[model samples]
Each structure stands twice: as structure tokens, then as C-alpha cells.
Target: MRDAFVRALLREMARDERIVLVTGDLGFGVLRPVKEQFPDRLLNAGIAEQSMVGLAAGLAATGRKVVVYSIGNFPTLRPLEQIRNDCAYHGADVKIVCVGGGFVYGSLGMSHHATEDMAVLRAIPGVTCFTPGDPAETEAVVPAMFQTPGTCYLRLGRGNEPHAHEEPVPDWRFPKAIRLREGRDIALLSAGGILVELKRAAEKLAEAGVSAEVVSFPCLKPLDREAVLSLAGRFTDLITVEEHTILGGFGGAVCEVIAEAGCPCRVHRLGLKDEFSAVVGNQAYLRHLYGIDGEAIAEKAMALINEKRTDAGRNP
Candidate 1:
């Protein structure tokens, strides 16, 4: 996903000379091509995330489309104040790009985990949040973020994430949920790179005779309310999966819409249960430990379906 973001960013930079990239002293290998092509446009802030954001905001104020690049919490949590005050407050065209959204840096430990980025960034007013689920979604989202007029937060996975969309999402618009597969039993809605696991879970559910619909939400803040409501009306069960905490993250966002609309759909959120990760290894290991992997998602979906069946039998 990081590679796809850079590729898309490169294309955008070529078209618009006003675009400048500021990094927090990382991503040298991945961003090398960017530095080589646009030598004058890239700047390194030497691990000072706050200054990086402030610089980006200043650049944006000077009529430059500035993108602050970093990994995990450095770009979001570390310099959140600068983002809120300097960028969002002034409606600066600053694109804050985070390379590792969830446990992409799990091996480094909990400090690097971006478990609450979506929720944190979404709370700030006038900040657009983009949590692309795969390289394809990342590719589609980068241009939209640049085209957007105000401050935007882009949460991306590390490189080599499996593509969820079979074909290019050429028609994808900002803040709209894309339905990857159609089903009837339940709907599996995912935000971020976990869409790959959701897709696998859908297949597993299908094998067990539970038809599951898969939807990817690339933009989280201005969530696709129409799509969420449509799914709520169509399906009795809606499961929201994210790599972040369930409390105020993707699941919380979905629940907010459903509850306010008085929708009868039962939402089962699959994510971190309001706690930080205690153990760490690789991304896959942590996902399994937290019970947000493909197998766990499949099992949870089946349990939800069975519970509904049991309830209907008892009522009838």
C-alpha cells in the first residue's frame, strides 16, 4: 500500500508542481524514487513530526499542496496538536500520509502501533480521513486527498498488501463504500488494510453456507452513510472490522449512523477491545492474537448467524 501511495503521489506531483513532500526522517528506500524525480520538492524534517506538520501547514498557506509523510503514530498521534491547530484550523491543503496504519510496525512494539488513528483524526473538525484497504484503494484515494481542499489524513498499510479489488477501481469516488461481493446472510464492512482478511472471511463463510457481502470503506470520516443504511435495511447483521480499537474507530463510526437512524441491524464490532497491544511479533501474529484475523472473523460471523437462528427458533 505504501508503494501504491508513492506511485500515485508521484503521478500527482508530476501534474502539479505546487505539491511538496515533507518526511520525518524515514522511508528513505521507499521514497528514494520520489527524491530522485522531484529533488527540489522533498524535504526531511529529521524525526521532528510536529515541525514536519507545521512546515507542511506553512507551505500549504503559501499556496503549495504539502504532504507530510511518516510511518504509524509519528504522523498522526505525535503531532496531533499541530495537525488540529495549524492545518485543520486554517483549512490548509496538507495531506498527512501515514505509511503503517495498524500493526504494520508490530515488530517495533506498541509505540508504533496506529490503533486509534482513524478515531483520533476523525474527531477533529474539517479533517478528512482516508483509510484505504489495499493498494488499489490506496491508488484511488491519493488523488482524491490531493484534490480535496482542506486537511486530510491518509492511513495506509505497509508494502505488499494483497489487492482486494480484482480490477482497477477507476470509478471510485471519495467517501463512498465499494461493495466487493454481494450476499444475503450478513454484510462484512471493513476499513483499512483488514479488507483482505474480510475478503478471506467472506470466502470461508460462503464455504460454510453463510453468504456474506464484502464492502470496503476507503474514506472513514465522511462515511458512506447511504451505503451503510442500505446495508442495514437489507441485512439483519452488520459486522464492522478494523485494525484499530473498536471504541471510537471504524465500528464506532458505523454504530453512530445505525443507532441514530433507528436501524434494527445488530452490529458486532471486531477489533481491539479498548486496550493497547501487550504482545507483539509480526502483523499477522498480532492480528491473530487480537482475534481480528480471517479465521477469527469467519468464526465470529458464523456465531452471529447461529445466534440469530437460535433467537428466531425460540421466538417462533
Candidate 2:
């Protein structure tokens, strides 16, 4: 995913000379190729996330397409006040690119975990949030951020991430959800790194003769109301998965839609609990510990389906 991010940025840089990449001195392996490709356009701000955001805002004020890149919590949580006041408040044309969202740096502890980033940033007006499912989607979405105006937050994970796209890359559009599978029984909605986990769970459910539809939401801020309603109307059950806490994450956004529209479906949310995670092994192990893995997800989905089935029988 990191390589794809670099490649996508390089492609955008080749086309747009106005694009400038700013970092906080942590993207050594990821930004090396970007620095080599666009020497004059890349800047390392050295451990100052607030200053980096301010600098990016200043650069954007000059009509330059600015991208501030750093680890997730550092970029999104640490400099949040600066981002909210400098970028989102002023409506800067700055793209905030965050790597290692959610539990990507799990072994590094909860301070590095970016569980509340989406919910926090989404609350800000005019700020766009995107979580690419895989390398191909990351490659497509990173470059498209340049075209969007105002503040755009692109959440990326660590290297060697899974590949969700089996075929060619789809069209790039921020604040939109992509339908990966179609089914009437259930709808599995996911965003960020959780999409990969949900995909595996869907595969296992398929093997158990369960037809589950999956929706990969690259964009979470705008919350695709049309898509949510359409899927909710078709499917009898809906499950939302994310790497963030159950509070105010992707599932919360979907629940808002269901309530407002009076849509009928049993929604099950899969994510971290309200408590902060302990210092664990790594991202993968931490996810499993929290019951966010494929097996756990499969179990939850199957249980929900059976519960719905029994309820219907009792009512009938």
C-alpha cells in the first residue's frame, strides 16, 4: 500500500507541477522515491505535525496543491487543532495523507492507533475522509485527491497490505462507496483496513452457503445516502465493519441513514470496543484479539442471520 501510494503520488506529480508533498520526517522508505522524483516539491518538516500542517496551509494559500504525509495519529490526531483551524476552517486546498491508520502500528501501542480519526475528522465541516481498501484502490484514490478542493484526508495503512481488487482498477472518486458484491441476504459494509478483514470473512461465509454482499466505502465523510438506502432496502441484514471504535465510526454513519430514512434491517457493527487497546503484538494480532478477524466476523454474521431467521419464523 505504501508503494502504491508513492507510485500514485508520482503519477499525479508528473501531471501537475503545482502538487507539493510535505512530511514530518518519518516517511523515509515511503517518500524516498517521491523525493527523488520531485526534489523541489517535497519538504520534510522534522517532527512538527502542527508546523507541517501550517506550512501546507501556507503552500495551499499560494494556489499549490499541497499534500501533508505522515503516520496516521501524528498527522490526524496530533496536529488536529492546526488541521481544523488552519486547513478545514480556512478551506485550504490541502490533501492530508495519513499512513498507518487504525491498528497498523498496533505493537507500537494505542497512542499510535488511529481509531477515532475518521469520526473526529468527519465531524469537521468540509473535510473529506477516504480509506482505500487495497493497493489498487489506494493507487487510484491518492492521485484523485489533487483534483478535490478544500481539505481531503486520505487514510492509508502500512506496507504489504492485501489486494482487494481482482480485476482492473475502478474509477477514482472521493466520498463514494464501491459495491464489491451483490446479494439479497446480507450487506457487509466496510471502510479502511477493515475492508480486507471483511472480505476474508465474506469468503468464508460464502463457503458456508451464505450469500453476502460487500460494500467497500473509500469515502466516509459525505456518507453515500443513496447507496446505503439501496442496499438496506435489498438486504434483510446489514453489518458494518471498521478498524475504529464502535462509537461514531463508519457504522455510526450508516445507522444515521437507517434511522433518518426509517429503513428496516438488523445492523451489526464490528470494530474495537470503547476502551483503548493494550500494547499488543502487531496490527494483525491486535485485530484478532479484538474479534475483528475473518473467523470472528463469520461467526457474528452467521449468528445474526440465524437470529433474523428465527425471529421471522416466530412472527409468522
In terms of lDDT, the poorest run of 10 residues in model 2 is 167-176
Q: What is candidate 2's lDDT per residue for 212-256, written digit by digit as tens? A: 888988878787888889888898778898888989988999999
Judging by lDDT against the true structure, name the best candidate.
1
Colliding pairs, model 1: none
User: What's the lDDT for all of these models?
Assistant: 0.93, 0.85
Candidate 2: segments with Cα more than 4 A from true spot? none
lDDT of 2: 0.85
Top TM-score hit: 1
